[model samples]
Target chain A: MPREVRERQMLDAAVATFARHGYRAASMDGIAELAGVSKPLVYLYLNSKEDLFTACIRREAAALVRAVRHGVDPATPPDRQLWEGLGAFFTHTAEHPDGWAVLHNQARTSGEPFAREVATMRADLVAFVTELIAAAAREAHDDPELGDREVAGLAHALVGAAESLAGWADTDGSVTAKEAASTLMNFAWAGLGNLMEGERWTPR
Target chain B: MPREVRERQMLDAAVATFARHGYRAASMDGIAELAGVSKPLVYLYLNSKEDLFTACIRREAAALVRAVRHGVDPATPPDRQLWEGLGAFFTHTAEHPDGWAVLHNQARTSGEPFAREVATMRADLVAFVTELIAAAAREAHDDPELGDREVAGLAHALVGAAESLAGWADTDGSVTAKEAASTLMNFAWAGLGNLMEGERWTPR
Candidate 1:
């Protein structure tokens, strides 16, 4: 394989290993072995274990954010947009279970730098949720009752519910993405609207 | 300290240390020193790190279950019962942050036997939510309308929301138990009622 292709293969192997064994437990030799290369060659491509892990975090985080962002269309009804965003999330998590595990489980446990990388991704995702709520509010102008606290709390609940549901859906091998999205919509949108009795949204 | 007092102290220290450092990262030596006991003494009472971790899981899991069970008054309205159950969950997670970390984060990540122990605790909580939904349906008097899959999905969403909120509230460091309870009540009760609309609690 070409160097770039070889490097990508090594990273893929590293992510899968990191996802299963966690950062502390995953060894560089094991990763190199999994990639069908020597440990020195793996180092030549990725430099070190820390660098390799960081690369994995950045790749996975960016992919997840990109997928969710791409899944949404700002022009659509906010409810529909939220559903698409959630669909994107569930799909990414399912398709890249190892990558998702690395980002969610291993990255956090890796401590310090790795934790910060995932934290940034979380904040980004949280902001996306905040915007979705604002859009929903704008689309359904009923009252001035929805305050920052309520919006923030609702966003937290929605995002958290999505994360939790992703893990749950993964465990029950039979569940589909459409089913997961619908469940979250029922659990979130109706309650949010009732709470928002009166809130207006405008362009940023 | 006497052996009984020393044992309790060791267990408390173990729970705190394990909560902070996780099962794999936490050292028995560190726990012993923190408890003001000798290493052999910790070994005397706890036997090994695995047993020590398991003991912590069992104790904290039982405490959490007891808190929720004790918090709800059986005579109250089903809404109130669910409200109280949620309140208990928030309170337990808040007051026992270390134990919460162990049960929610550590044990769940450790895999297999440890995971199963915590899984049992989670199953209890899920069953409680399932039963609560059934009772809500029974009280409402209309046909439940929801299939087993739908109810199970809702239960998972609710449980995940509760767990997520617990972690979020802790991270923010300012949300009190009452505020957390109200946040959840606002987010959940209305959404829950929407499902049971034909039965009892109208969406309005």
Candidate 2:
């Protein structure tokens, strides 16, 4: 097999192992056997367990980012774009449960460089959502009610909501990706739509 | 001082240390000095580092849950209740940044018992939000449009959004707790209000 194919197998095994057994408990021998590769080859190719885990984080994060980016088309209306983006996110997370677990569950808590890697991805996602919301606001009205800070806050909230929903769907098993996407879309877009129209919810 | 007072001091110090230096890096010596107690006294009171961290998690988690519960009035309208609940949540998180960090960041990734401790708090929060949303749905319509599963999903999304917004406010520093609460209230209430009125965002 090509080195690339072998490396992919190793990463797949590593993500599943890390997600199922956690970072501290996941063993190299198990990962090697799961990959169907020799222990020495696993070490030689991935360097170490830490490096292999880092590789898994980078690949999964990139894949998720790319999935959302590709799912959204700039030419589409903002709400549609968000719908597509969220659909893509939920679908990817649902399909790649192990990868999602690695990124959201394992890497984040495993410490140091791993957490930082996920943070960078999170920052990128927040920035992407921020731009999306800002554009939607500008398009909706001449004078947008959402200030930059508020827009930033909204983006964080939306991303967090999606993440939480994804985790929920993962655990519930019965919820499909489409259902997760719709749930968040209704929760977020209607809220954003109301905000755009200046129908703010104030304390009574 | 009495044991209860001394224990509170130790937990306060532990939470701050764990938040700042992280669980593993946080030292018994540092926590003891910060708590104004001897190292042996710290051990005697808290038992061990693991126990001290667990104590911090339990204390902070309970305090957070209590604050949110106390913030809402059952007699008030559902929307008002949500607003007050969110307001209370943001205020608590903002005021207790160290405790928030300990629960949100430190306890979650520290592994095993610590992670489970935070999960229990999270489940309780989710259940509380679920009940609130379900009550609102029932109040809004005789035949609620939101199914049980959908309501459950919305609860997860809302909790996730609050968590995200709290973290954002903590980092931005300029964003006050009131601002965070208001931002989410608008984002969530407006969306949820529309959903109650059957104004969902369908794909175009």
Candidate 3:
């Protein structure tokens, strides 16, 4: 096999193992066996267990970000865009449960460099959501009353909600991607829509 | 001082040190000195570094839950309840940044027992939110249309959003706890209100 193909296979096997057994207990022997390659060859190609895990985080994070970005259409109305974007995100996460587990659960808790890798991906997602919200607000009104800091806060909240819902979907087998997406849409859109129309929820 | 007071002081020091330096890098000597106690006495009371850290997680988690519970009034209408609950949450997190860090950042990534500790607190918070949503939905309609699973999903999303905003508030010093609570209220309540009114955003 070509080196890249072989490396991809290694990463695929590694992500599954890491997702199942977690970082510390996931053995390189299992990963190599799953990849149908010798242990020494696995080490030779990936360098070390840490490097292999890092590779998995990078690949999975890129794939997730790409999936969400591709799922959204820039020209659509903001609500439609958000719906599609969320659909893509939940679908991607549901389909790639192992990868999602690695990125959200394993990589984050494993420590410094790994957590940092996932943080970058999260930051990208937050920024994407921020732009979507800002554009939506601008489209809703001539003046765009939502300030940068408020937009930033909303983005963080939306991303966090999505992240939380994704984890819930993964654990609760009955929740399909569509259902998860709809739940978040029901939980977010009207609030965001109200904000766009300058309808703030004030204390009574 | 009494042993309970001494232990509390040690936990306070440990939480601060852990928050500042993280788990592995946080030193027992620093914690002990900060608590103004001998290192051996600290060990005698907390037993080990792991136990000390665990103690910090438990204490902080309990305190956080208590603050939120105390801040909310059950007799109030649901939106008011959510608003007050969120206010309590953000205020607690901001004022107890070190404790929040221990629960949100440190314990979660540190490993099994620690992560489990934080998870319990999170579960409690999610359940609290779930009840609040369910009650709100019931109050909004003669017969609540929102099902059990949907409420569960929304609770997860709301909790996740609050968690994300708390982290954002910690990082962005200018964001007051009231501002964080208001931002979430604006981001969540209207959407929730729409759902109660049977207005969901369907994909066009």
Candidate 4:
């Protein structure tokens, strides 16, 4: 097989191994065996355990970003766009559970290098959501302007909630991707809409 | 020192060690040294590493639950109760950053035993939030009632959002516990109140 094909196979095996055994316990030998390649070849291709883990993080993060970006249509309204993006996110995570595990569970907990990689992906997604929220606010005529910090906070909350819901959906096989997305939309978008309208919930 | 005092000291040291180095890399020897006790004494008091870790988890979880429970007053309205509870949570986490890290980052990422301990605490908090949401819904008299699963979803979202904000607040010192709780209340409670009033945000 070609080098590219071989590299992909190694990464697939690496993600599976890392997701199952975690970052510390996962071995190059185990990854190589799972990849059906020699240990030397695994080392030759990926270089080291850290490098292999980083490679897996980058690949999974990119795939996730691509899925969300593809699912969203620029022409659609802000709510529709968010809905579509969330649906794609749930579908992609469900289909690639191991990849999701690597990005969400393993990478963040491993160490600085891996955690930073996942954090970068998260920052990008948070920025995207922030833009959508600002756009939604703009669409609502005469709505009060949201400060940058508030927007960032809302984006972080929404992303965190989506991630939590994704884990819940993954654990319970009966819950569909669409259902998860809808639940988040109702839980979040309605709130965002209310915030945009200056309908604040004050302490009694 | 008495046995109870020594045990408390050991758990505090264990939490710091586990939070900084993670579970697999963290050693009982390091924990003993940090606690200013001998290895044999540490082992004698806490038994094995597993039990020691479990003890740390239970202590931290209980402390957290106690803080929230103490902060909320039953006589106050649901919104005030949630606000007070969140304030207590943020204060407790900020004060015990290491313990918070152990529960939020380390414990969950560790194996089944530790994760389940943290999960039990999480379930309790989620249940508490669910009851608050149900109360808020009831307050908005004659409005549409949210299904049980919907309330559960909302509770999870709120808890996840709170966790995310806690981490953010810990990283940035300028953000106080009160500020974090208020931001979450504004971001979440508003939407929840709207939902209870049958004000849903739909895709256009």
Candidate 5:
């Protein structure tokens, strides 16, 4: 087989292996065996375990950012943009469960280097959400009434909400991406605008 | 020290060590050393690493649940209840950073018996949020609008938001518990009733 094809195959195997066994637990030998390659060749393509794991993080992080960035329409209103953004996230996570695991579960758990690597991805998502909230306020109040600290907090909450729902949908494979996204939208966007009037829900 | 105080000290040491090094990586010897006790004595109190970790989870989980439950008043509106619950969560997480790490970071990553153990605490929190969201809906619509599945999803969002923000606050030590709670409230509770209006924040 070609080296490029073999490299892709190795990455596929590495993502799966890393997802299941985390960084420290997963050895290059195991990954190479899974990839149908010799350990030496695996080393040839990916240097050390640290580099290989870094490669895995980079690959998964890039894919996620690309998917979410490309999925949503920039021209749409903030709400629709968020809806599309979440849909993209759910779809990507479902399609690439191993990649999501590598980024979310494994990367941070592995330690500082990898955590910082994934933190960049997380910060990207947070920045996206922050900008969205600021823009919404601009369109809503026609001025940035929300303070810097408040906006930062809002961005964190939004990202957290998305992350929470992602894990939820990940475990419950029966739930569709669109369905999960819409459910989150209702949960988050439904009760918003306390300044307008309290649209609170109550139990029967 | 008294037996209870000594046991608490050992448990605290174990949790801090485990949170730092992870369940698999953490050692009883290190825990004992940190507790300023001999290894044999550490075992005398907590028994084994597994037992020690479980004890940590139980302690942290109970404390977290109690804090959140204590913060919310059943008689108050669901919105206020959620806000107060968030405040308690932020405060507990901030005060007991090591305990929070054990429950939030280490417990989830450790897998198996530990994960299942923390899952119980998590489920309780989710249930509370689920009922609160349902109650909020019923109070608003005067009927049951949000279904069981939907409520579950919303609860997950709320919990995830809280968990995410908790980690955020822990890492960004400059941000206080009160600020974190307010951030979550704004991000989650704001403009929720605008389901018809369809408002959302997205990257501009």
Candidate 6:
């Protein structure tokens, strides 16, 4: 097979191995066996264990970003865009459970470099959500703009909630992607709308 | 030293070692050395690496639960209780960063036995939050009760957001426990209160 095809196969095997055995326990030999390639070829292509793990992180993160971006349409209202994006996120994660685990579970727990890679991807997602939230606030003609810190907090909370729900959905097959997306929408969007209107929940 | 004191010391060492080097990489010899105990005594006290890790999980989980429970006064309203509980949580996690990492990051990623222990503690927390959400809904004399699943989703989202913020706060020293608690309260409570009052944010 061609180099590109061989590289893809090696990555697929690496993701599966890393997801199954984790970053430390996973070996190049095991990955090579799973890829149906020689161990030397695995080393030749990926270079080292760290490099292979980084390659897996990059491929999986890009796929997830592409899925969410493709699901969203810039023409739609902010809430609808968020809805579509979340739906796509759940669907992709469900279909690619190992990839999601690699990104969410394995990458974060690995050392600094791998963790940084995942964080960069997460930052991009947070920025995307932040833009949608700002757009919604603008369209509503809200008097006071949410502070940048507050927007960032909301975005992080939103993404964290989505991620938690994705794990829940993955574990319980009965929970559908649409259901997870809608639940988050109800849980989050209403709160954002309330915040924009200057309605706050203070300690009693 | 008394057996109880020595056991506590050993657990502390284990938490530090596990947090730094992860489960697989952390060894009995390392923990024993850190605890200033003999390797045989360490094994005698904790049985095995798995048991030692489990003991750490139980100790940290109980401490966390105690901190949150002690922070909240039952006589106050649900919102106040939640606020106080969150404050305590952030404070405790901030103070015991290694323990928090052991429970939240290392234990969960280690495997089934360790993950289940953490999950049980998490379930207790989720139940606590779910009750608060329910009480808030009842206080408002809402149109209808949130379904069990819906409440569970909100609870998980709330917990996930708190976990994410705890991490962010740990990384950025300027973010105090009080600030983290306040941000989460605003981000979560307003939306929850709105949902109870039959206010909804839908796609436009």
Runs with alpha carbons beyond 4 Å of true place in candidate 3: none
Q: What's the TM for model 5?
A: 0.88
Give one clash count per candidate, in the order shown: 3, 0, 1, 0, 22, 0
lDDT of 5 by residue, B1-204 (tens): 898998888998998998898898898888888898899998888888899999999999999999999998989876788788888999999999999999888887676678789889998999988888777777777555566787788789889888888988999889999888876776566544443233443433
Lowest summed lDDT window (length 10), candidate 1 chain A: A195-204
lDDT of 6 at B44: 92
lDDT (10s digit) by residue, model 3, range B1-204: 888999889999999999998899999999999999999999999999999999999999999999999999999889999999999999999999999999999999888899999999999999999999999989888888899899999999999999999989998899999999999999999999889988888777
Overall lDDT per candidate, in order of appearance: 0.82, 0.95, 0.94, 0.87, 0.81, 0.86
Error of 2 at A10 (Å): 1.2
Candidates, ranked, lDDT: 2, 3, 4, 6, 1, 5
Candidate number achieving the greatest DockQ relative to the actual structure: 2
> Highest lDDT, which number?
2
Off by over 4 Å in 5: A24-30, A190-204, B20-30, B33-36, B110-113, B191-204
Q: Which scores greater on DockQ, model 1 or model 2?
A: 2
True contacts kept of each: 0.47, 0.95, 0.92, 0.62, 0.62, 0.59
Model 3 score (lDDT): 0.94
Query: Candidate 5 chain A: minimum summed lDDT over ten consecutive residues — where?
Result: A195-204
lDDT of 2 at A112: 92
Query: Chain B, TM-score, each prediction?
Result: 0.91, 0.98, 0.98, 0.95, 0.89, 0.95
lDDT of 4 by residue, B105-174 (tens): 8888776778899989998998988888887777776564787778878888888888888887877777
Ranked by lDDT, the better of candidates 2 and 6 is: 2
Of the two candidates 3 and 6, the one with more favorable lDDT, higher being better, is 3
Task: DockQ for every model, please.
Answer: 0.35, 0.92, 0.89, 0.60, 0.48, 0.55
What TM-score goes with each of the models?
0.88, 0.98, 0.98, 0.90, 0.88, 0.87
lDDT score, residue A164, model 5? 79
Which model, 3 or 4, shows the larger lDDT? Answer: 3
DockQ of 5: 0.48
